[model samples]
Target: MTTQFSALFPGLDNPLILKRYPDSSDANLQAWDAADEHLLKHLDESGMLPRRWLVINDSFGALTCALRARHGDTPIDFAADGRTAHLGALENLQSNSLCQQEIHFHDCSQLQSLGNDAAILMKLPKNLNFFADTLSQLSQTLRAGQQVLIGAKAKHINQSLLTLIGKNLGEANASLAWKKTRVIVVTADGKPRPLSKPNRWPVPELGLILENHSNVFAANKLDIGARLMLDNLPVGDFSQVIDLGCGNGVLGLQTARLYPNANVHFVDESAMAVASAMANWALNKLNPDLGKFHWDDCLSHLDAGISADLVLCNPPFHQGEAITDHIAWQMFNDAKRSLKPGGLLHIVGNRHLGYHVKLKRLFGNCKTIASNGKFVILQSVA
Candidate 1:
């Protein structure tokens, strides 16, 4: 079930072996898509000279790895909001026997003040607000005549998108369609644009203030699924708790407040989400020792011997642009494996997802804790 493929870029010394983060068994769903190929092809044809390259929004390191393979020993500053994509790139580097020291990693917060004279390579993110924010920050770092290359599905690049790019960055144009995808070329005009701040709101009912970064789920408000889950949190004398796929750490923050004696873990694939969760935990004045934040792919990198008495999840049904249930499946399986004997996994999912079936398949029992029109809360005992 290991999903690995060779990525052949036009100018690479050899094809690099690539795999998606939180690897899935489905071969049809590859780590890289045609948009990635289209971008690389454009770069290959440009014959751009070696320079400090900034790579952003690389789904699973396809753009990063291919660039590294082509430009060895060049300074490549890789920025990804997702921890999985960052880790996946490093894993691919090791798998391909490529130099690990060639690439430098950064979270979104650290992207500012990176200085000028760098070529930027980016894959248009699913969240346009986040993309605009990124472009705004780049405007501060890139001078006139410097360009940023963006790759995306052709259908997603329209006049509005081009307008947004021009407003945030500079002149923008899409290349001719190649493989039903296009690489957007944007030049910086040396004019700095203000970056957008994270969305903040107070959930007075829960007595908590939540802030969500651009890429985090449920921006500016509580998600219905999470709301249902929050209302139906399990009654237990649990000590160690994990909020799996903890976007903005809302569930874990509540759990920490409810169980003052328990150690709560907030884990997510997004660095921005983890940072937001950490900030929220502190802003709420929760017991510092009672909270731990992890930027991770499910529980794969959780500390050893960290079995949880309760695991809470409102699992994501998508990874980047692909709307699939593989991540949800992975979260349930990981929850089962991470729970202690007699421990429980509590989850909130849309009714149509049939999460109960997956939980039953893994744990042999699934019970509905609560249900509303759109969301259902379910529990499974380990």
Candidate 2:
């Protein structure tokens, strides 16, 4: 990633300084994208600034930082499903020396708390269902005739996309392409749409019923790798456990079921994911005292005194649109730090990911406890 980001958004007299979350080296990525620039460029040209503004799905806070830089006292509100995005945006704001005194940070779930007239600027997200859910929720609060501007790659805009927006929020239209990106203008209808029901499915085999919010990974079904890991979990005496990246808390839920005495910690970066995990734990009637749910970036912010005798992981391979192994690499390193001496890290991954190589390097020893044609379950001792 670029060590420093300098994007010349049109409204700003000077370029804004920004950086991706968990800042480090890797030149393959930048802090902002053309879509982000397109939205800001359109705003500068429109000259229709509202008393307050809400920025959504800002990736690394490029839009929030740019808007904050250009209009410091505008009472900007920022929201994203990713905790990492929130962290990145706050850092970018401080790094640029922008005053956050009037900038309000919130989750989309709290849209009702903000002013109804606040203009919304958003970058289209990768997940359509989550976007639809957000639109439905926003429609409940935003007043009629309000505009929500969404930016996306030109290739991603289409009639069907507009239709989806209309059904959920209001009428929509697209603008001329700039730098292979376009801004979508949506007019709010002020009609309340029914919120989407949480996805609930029975895992009769495991005697578990899983409920997942729209943004949770594998929310609708049991992923194949998790299925394999569930079958081959290392049987041992375990007391304290961590489910790193615990989407929907399935792994941690299973831990609570198998080892009733163990403290099962479910940690994830998505707020919906953490909430879903906690909800699922309650839904399954698991022991309340043994379950802990955390919305955090891996285990980095876990309670200081907490250490795990066992860590179960099904690490994600992608961050937003970029497919990379950096996340899995971080999870392994974090597991090593949080594990007690002689503790174990058990993970399942696609056969092609070569995770065993990294595990061996980090833990000094890695064992292939189970394998199938598509997935491999590996274990490491700290």
Candidate 3:
């Protein structure tokens, strides 16, 4: 079944066509949320568009698409931490018969390239640390007394959040609630603030140290699922191994420790996560040639020539604020497609996720290797 999201863009007569990246089969998930609509609405009502637009953290590029649709000639710059956001934005732009080349695309790491002259439009991220880092980065390049407009659910807007924004960027205030959403208007002070520092934590049992940026999952600590996965690793003389959705490279680092000669690949959608994994690999003094890092959505972009003998996964059940298993579903499917004959897929998940059922359906055999009260280690063979 095919599902398409027509954006709730009030200005456009026909809604802009949009879809989530990797295109979810589940209809419940959407490319854009209310916050995105609220931001676009504010822009429309302002009566005059910004001279130039700088958009941040657009989930699937709804804001970019709407802006492009309304004023095709305006300069629009977009940035986000996830590769999927960029890809989805590009796809949405093309689907709506808009020229993608009109928009300047930047990854989160490319914040320096984004000039401060444009009107800054932002979607309040779930990770305030990442948001603060963004503000700090903007403070460096943006002119003194510049303003940034942020859109978020009304419930998420509060004084503490405003203070955090002001502390990093400038004084902030929220607009009256509209559609259960509020626009946080922030004025950037001329002062530059230091960016968010990476977090470091030690794994005494494995003799590994991990440093991750603000957006990386379990950035500052070892998560319980990974801890459980580490204990139930499968025994195999594997050569090509992949740490699918490797966050901070914990599973891959430990796998390399167990199998010194096997090549380990760390793949993730977040640029920071990939960087963190690569850094952790070097921090552990692993063989430089044996470890590979990729900023990717699942194994969708993995090189076809590289077939994996084993895949270690601690799949994320959510994408952004949506608590859907689409990501885990895609991860499982990609792992099957990337594995060699009879290759093993080892994963850890909460007992309630019913991943065993998914594995059984995909591979025809799902083996429960280990279980605790909260987590289960499941294995499947291709």
Check candidate 2 and list the clashing pairs. 1-26, 1-27
lDDT of all predictions? 0.87, 0.87, 0.89
True lDDT of residue 317, candidate 1: 86
Model 1: per-residue lDDT, tens digit, 40-115?
8887899996568888888788888887778887888889888888888888878887786758898777666763
Clashes of 3: 0
Q: Which digits, one per residue and each the tens of the lDDT, describe model 2 over residues 1-382? A: 3578688888778888778886746666778999998898888899876888988888888988888788768988898888889889889989988888878877656655554778899889888888888888888887889899999999999898999999998999999999999999999998878877679998998999999887889967889999998898777789999999989888888878889999999999888898889999999998889899887877878887888899999999988987778889999999999999989999999999999999999989999999999999999999
- Quote each prediction's TM-score: 0.96, 0.97, 0.97
Instruction: Mark the 10 consecutive residues where model 1 has the least summed lDDT.
Output: 108-117
| Candidate 1 positional error at 168, Å | 1.6
Report the C-alpha lDDT of model 3 over 271-382, residue by residue, as the tens digit. Answer: 9999999989999999999999998889888999999999999999888988988899899999999999999999999999999999999999999999999999999999
